[model samples]
Target: MLQLDLKTTVFLASIMSALMSVVLLSAYHSFPRSIRGIGQWVAGSLVLVVAPMLFWLRDIAPAWISIVLANGLLLAAVALWTLGTQAFYGRPPARRPAAIVVVAATLAVTWFVYGRESYEARVTIVTFAMGIFFGAQALLVLRHGGRDFSARFFGFLLAVQTLVVLARGMASLFAGLGGQTLFAANDVIQTVYLGSYTLMDLGLSVAFMLVITRRLHVELDILSRTDPLTQLLNRRALYDAGQRELAHMAEHGGEMALLLIDLDHFKHINDSLGHAEGDRVLTAFSAMLKRELPAGAHPGRFGGEEFLVLLPRTTMAAALALAERLRATSSRFFGRQVADLTISIGVASVDKAEHRLDGAVRRADLALYRAKSAGRNRVEAVMEAAA
Candidate 1:
């Protein structure tokens, strides 16, 4: 049992250290400019410092002093945990006065206990205060906004820690009153209480690490589907969306439209000015499209100098009108000195029986080809060609 307890303590300490390192490193990389990240780093670093302090002070002179210090360290950990939770949930800044109150109260109690003649009363009061503060914070998180698994896990950990503190407080109170006279009995109680609390703290730390890892994974997935420059769905995302839309339309009877827009004389702009200026134009045009399109429309960069817009509930006439509006907007905006910049738009709306988005896009391409051949800066509907 002694070997097992020692191994568990060491393993828990190592895990806590690893989690603290990850939180610090991630904050550095992702949130260097954020004040909240800085606060979390400070808190995490302090916890790392204090965990070892708690272990070292276990056998220090005047047992109440060690108890006071350990409680103080746990309070610090709670404060840091609050800050980290707020940062993750995008909650507003925590009140400074409340944080100051918690810290000052812990310190004042620590000082008072260190000077107290009766160690039992001092330890009991300090332990109760620790439990109240930590338990209250955990309950607040659980009641307000901790809906995710990480938040719930954290709450559970805090509740368990609070119980451990309460158990320790009871043990100390009983020992001080001479209710448990045997030294071996006291040792067994102390060992069990410390062992349980250590394991609880270690579990919470690991849970927080898992939450950060999961959040990072989700962010990476979003980045993969988004265009870095335009901040729009990239071609791959658009293709997936198109496939889904195709399947939905096959089941329901609704018209879907595809608009393929190509900038006129884009190569000339790159040649006359610079690629940098050309990039600006593309970005500006993308922003304009995003602003002009109605809600529920999906716009994406099809490639260099080309864009695609999907309108799920639009008819052929409505799609043509939107294309015309886009052409006019581009003409007015890019007319000053950009070679009378205009867009040739090919619009194709699904016919009543058509069930394929790819077929619709091919028809739109053909119409767009005809529009360019006839004259640039025009909206050509595929149905118009057959009419």
Candidate 2:
């Protein structure tokens, strides 16, 4: 059997930690700027790389430098990991509290190093503090991270690392800190502790990168499908979704409706109030659609100043009522927020024999043209052929 010594394990762990830090840095530079938390993770991994090197220095350096400062770096690394998790979830990183905890833990380790020189006390304190941070990471992921494989994998790693750290802390109380000096004993507990720490160091670094990559992919997907300014489904995505919905309704024998809306005199608003004000109006209308649209309604930005709404299992009458409601509310909203603006909506329902979404949209477009031709700020509907 090949035995792994504490010094060899620590040295290997330091090398691996530095390599992982490089990997994270590369990913941060290569990936989109929208992905968060990689910077903090990189910072933590670099700190971890330094920490094990100091541990390897041990007797060559003073106790305060090798033990206290090294342990302080370890605590700081955990704190940074916690902060990274928070940043990934778009939550505020309460830096003051984490900084306070790291400072206090370092002071406690310093006391054990110089004041009394008890290895057991120092190991116990450091392990317990580290366990706390690991536990926090796990809990945060469980609460906020979505039900995705990357999230679960990362959370599980954090949970297992927490258990390992806590077990080491408990073992330190009974195991007498390995020997007169730290890592002096070649016992089973010490060997397991060092081996597990190294494994976890590598595992967690990879896991953090996985989480960041997954988020980057998700952001890119959303960006591709959504309008940049309004954050609604873009024209292509809207058409795709409409086709899918229409196919489903065709197979299931259900009615569907389309509403084509155009903001009246939108160009005038942009030319007069500036494009910035026009964007605000569009964003506000998108928000209103998100809040006011009924269940089973899909709203999208078809083009500039034109929006589309798809209503599944809806009749022409119901679609007209909904359109009126939207027109009235939008008039009031824009009146208060921007200028006295109004919208014209054209509604159309699917024919029982027709399964295509484009036909309904075309009819709705015609109705919208009529609405604009007659006057602005009104609701019009083209009945299905069956009706």
Candidate 3:
């Protein structure tokens, strides 16, 4: 049987960790600026790898430079990982707890070395510190990530690592102390500890890259389908969703309603208030649609200053009411937020299979033109055609 020793596992893991860090850091920098926190994750992995490598040098170097330094670096690495997780979920990085952990661990390590030669005490305190940091990193992911699968998985991984570390720390109380050094390549307990640490930290390094990549993919997907300024589904997404809903309603049997909404004098607002403020108007109107639109309504940006809302299982009168609500919400925000910002909406109702959604949208567009002609900030309903 081939037995794995502490130095062998630690050295191999260190080299692999450094390589992984380089690749991850390179990829993170090459990615678009929208995806945040990859840098911190890579840096943390690098520090973690270096910490173990430093431990391997304990026999040749001073205890302060080797054991204490390695433990301090390990704490720093956990802090970086926690900070990265915060950034991953769009939360501000917290520094106080990390500072506290580093300070406490440093003091403990200093006292163990200066006041006494109790290696067990020194190792026990370091284990608890590492466990605390690991637990904290896990909590950061859970708190900010909520039920997100990737985030939860990463947090769970940290929790597992924490359990292993904390168990070792407590187990030390009952285990017999001997003359074996932590870095002794042949020490059984040392080998077990180093092997477990290497495996767990390696898993963390790999997991971080996976989570970052998944986040970047998700962000790219959202960016592709949504309007950048309004954060609403774009015209392509609107058409796709409309087609899907039409198919769904065809099978399920429901009335499908389409509303074409045009911001009243949107061009005038852009020219008068500048495009920057005009963007604010569009964003505000999109927010109102999100809040006030009927339940299950899919609101999308149809074009410049124009939006499309699809409501399923709706009657003509109900569709009209929704359109009026939309008009009112936009009109109510006029003068106070944006200069005279209001919307003209055209409502069209039809059975799911009566005609394609594009045809219904065209009819709704015509009604919207009618609303603009009659007066701005009003809803005009296009009646279902005779069978």
Candidate 4:
């Protein structure tokens, strides 16, 4: 195995951390601003970049500057990492609590430097503090992080770092730091501790980037499939979902139903009340669909002021009942802003023998036309199979 002196290793680690900060900063700009944690990670990496340089200056510099300040900054870096993890998960940051913890840990390190002068005491204190920070971050990610490979990998690395840090703290408290100077130890634990810090720093930075990239892809996928205004599935997604359900029915011998809905006199509402209020009515209707639909129902915005729903395992009778209920209840969703808004619906059902959605969709459209012609705000259905 290759070996480098502790000073050289610390110097290289500082250089590596500096380079990692550059990478993180680049990522911060590359990712969308809404992503939240890249900025904090960049700050944490920059802080870490300074800590090893201070550690390398230990003998030449005053103990307060090299030991106390270095350890304090180390603790602060970990606190920032915890904050970044919180932000990544969309949790409110515990800034005041993290500040208190970092400050208290720094004070403990300072007291040992100025008053007690115990090397083992300082090592134990700083390592334990780092363990707490890394452990908290690991918990936050592992518990709430999405079930993706990048998230699991990132959380796993943090968990490993937490265990390594806590193990070192225990060794310092019980077994001692092994020598007067950290480098003097020439011990396995010391080498592993320093090496782990450097490698974990690199691994975690890359892992965080991967996590952010994965999340960006997921968000973009959702954006492509959903309507921006109503946050419901868009036309393409609705068709795809219906096809899948149709395939399932073909195999399982079940029935499927659809509802094509239109907001009555929506263009008048837009022209009279302006697009803003028209948007409110659409949003209210979408929210009502989400709240009132059954578990197996798939709802989407078909177009302007038009929505479609595909309900698997539902009969035409059940679908018409649901449409009636929706028509009756929709008025409650809008306030005085659009008090007179109403919806008309067309319901159609397909049994297992039917394989295509277009025929059913066409029939539903015709039914919708009839409902609109007969006077709005009524439910209509086409019972016959389309030839």
Candidate 5:
């Protein structure tokens, strides 16, 4: 018969709690800024308080101290639940007063029960209070923001914690109800319970760390491929897309058009209104281009005030018509406030018979120079010379 002592049980629980706290702290430091920092702090606090309390349980003369500590842990968990709800679901503070009230009531009940004559009453009250709190937190998270991965992940962790608490409560209840025989294999039962809880805790922590890492990676990827000022595809993305389009055209005999657009005297905007206003103008112009272009077309900010558009599966004539529409749209949109806020557009189409994408852009650049000479606010299509 393998008999276990209470001191050993408390020691093991303390060690496991401490280990979990360290793991969570490591995850918190490594987590992305996007994750709610408050949630991490709450988790860290819960582990810190509970672990030390578990170790001190034997030395404390009055059992009421342990009861108070347990209630305090639950209180911290409830506060964490509130912060998690706000961060994950964007919940208003006024929406869930019930949560706070329940936690307060649980704390009061736990304190009152600890002073009761019956040890069974104390055990039952504390166990049920913690279990209920965990379950409620899980339900709230699932109801409010279950769609997001982080919300669901937190909810799952809460649910598992609730189950662990419930199992502990049941073990205590059986012991109190004069069913000592039921705990004949108490050591085995407790070992299994602790093992399962530890595993769940570790799994949830690892998942959260992975989620934060992935979010950081995605943000970095977007920053690498996007222009910060205009919020458009940067030159690198544009060139890569152009190369891919050209390769597809070569393989499938489809046509694509490229339009290089330059803002006329954009330097005048910066000089007159400051760089902030210049940024606004560029952002507004980019938005207009995005709104005007067709679904298949790709637009990019090609450094400075220059922009490029790739029109896929379109003929030279269609490209010219699209450019004319864009020119007209810009004129109408910017006519009132920004005087002479005009653009010069040079259009070129893939000429599979004679030139490649780069050659076509060069020809378009020549036409663009011609357009500036002919006066801005116009579109020019490059006409290939005779072979």
Candidate 6:
């Protein structure tokens, strides 16, 4: 393997970062609109690459380009990174604060280029700003972003980067940083500082990609298990939960009951009030179920106009009362809008020996059918369901 020095490492790192940014930018365009902040990240990464390249060209470039322009772009990139971090987590960016910091950093650089030309002053200002913005990004990740390993790692990296950058800024004053540009570093401290910055670039890029991919996977899993309309667990998830609940009941002696519920006159509402109104009714009823279900109830959408709830450590009488409450609430709520809007509920106590969700559900479903036959707006028990 070829040996590399600080300058060579920085150069290669910049190139790699630029390449990664470009690839990510292209990928950002391909990502769904549901994923936020990719555009800001893409733009910020490009600006970030430009900052270092300009720093490297300090000897050849004009003071305005190297000092003012480079620092401005660097701060801009940090602002964008903060914004991107917020966006990735579906949170709003701290625009006013970021804008203030960017302006301050750029003004400090402008003063260095035009007035005092003091490298220490410029470095202090820029590094402090970087530390603050990096800290802000770390906060964003921990606050609203994913709690997965990759997300946590990214936040930790940002926190460490913040401390290091701030320490660099503080140490620069004591180190007698006279006129040392980023590239023309004479001491070990400057070289180490630059090296750390390069490593930060590499680490954050990899961490953020992992965070994005992991979050998407989590969201896809949720989408698969949940019904889009009612925001309830879908049939698969319901059955899965039922199976698990039964297993738990086998181990721990607990009474388990199933409630098979159907919206009464739902087809008529869809036909008379239109599908849009019917959808609203479904959503309202879903909200009601969420509010009215007993504590620790496992509610799921069984199918169209049908829902199931599993109640563990609950009696048939308690289940009946809860079902009655749901029916009364539904009647009072939907009755005003549509006269015949009501729900039929059927309760079936799961037999300890049966050990199956399907068998329990079948009994509850028969009870539901009985409720439908006997005037459509009442609760029926297991025996009533059998008839």
Which ranges of candidate 4 are over 4 A from the true structure? Answer: 332-337
| Candidate 1 global lDDT | 0.70
All predictions: root-mean-square deviation over Cα?
Answer: 5.3, 1.8, 2.4, 1.6, 5.1, 2.4
Judge candidate 5 against the unseen true structure and give its global Cα lDDT, from 0 to 1. Answer: 0.67
The residue ranges of model 5 lying beyond 4 angstroms of the native Cα positions read 1-61, 78-105, 108-112, 115-191, 247-253, 351-357, 383-387
Clash tally, candidates in order: 0, 0, 0, 0, 0, 0
lDDT of 5 by residue, 1-387 (tens): 656554444455555556656765765676665656435434744554474354246336454455555445544554554455455444554335535654665566555545444444444565566676567667776786436676578678878878876876786677554433212345555555445544544554554454455556767888898998877899888777878887788788888888999888899999998999889899999999999999978789987999988888988899899988988888887786588788889988767653345677787787778788999999998866220
Position 332, candidate 6: lDDT? 95
Worst 10 residues of 1 by lDDT: 177-186
Better lDDT candidate (3, 5): 3
TM-score to true structure, per model: 0.73, 0.95, 0.91, 0.96, 0.73, 0.93
lDDT of 6 by residue, 235-310 (tens): 9998888888788888987878889999987999889879998888888888889998878888888998899998
User: lDDT per prediction?
Assistant: 0.70, 0.87, 0.79, 0.87, 0.67, 0.83
* Pairs of colliding residues, candidate 6: none
- Model 1: residue 67 alpha-carbon error in angstroms: 5.0
| Per-residue C-alpha lDDT of model 2 across residues 289-342, encoded as one tens digit per residue | 889899878899999999999898887778888899999899888888877689
In terms of TM-score, which candidate is strongest? Answer: 4
- Candidate 2 residue-wise lDDT at 213: 86
* Greater-lDDT candidate between 4 and 6: 4
TM-score winner, 1 or 2: 2
lDDT of 4 by residue, 257-356 (tens): 9999999888998899899988877887788799999998999999998899999999888999999999888755544447667888988887567767
Q: Write the per-residue lDDT of candidate 1 for residues 154-236, one digit (tens) a residue.
A: 67877877887787789777755344321123366556655665565556666666556556666777778888888888888
Q: Which segments of model 6 are wrong by more than 4 Å?
A: 1-6, 144-147, 383-387
lDDT tens digits, residue span 289-334, model 3: 8988867888999989899988888888888877777677667777
Give the RMSD in angstroms, all C-alphas superposed, for model 2: 1.8
- In candidate 1, residue 137 scores what lDDT? 53
Question: By lDDT, is 1 or 3 better?
Answer: 3
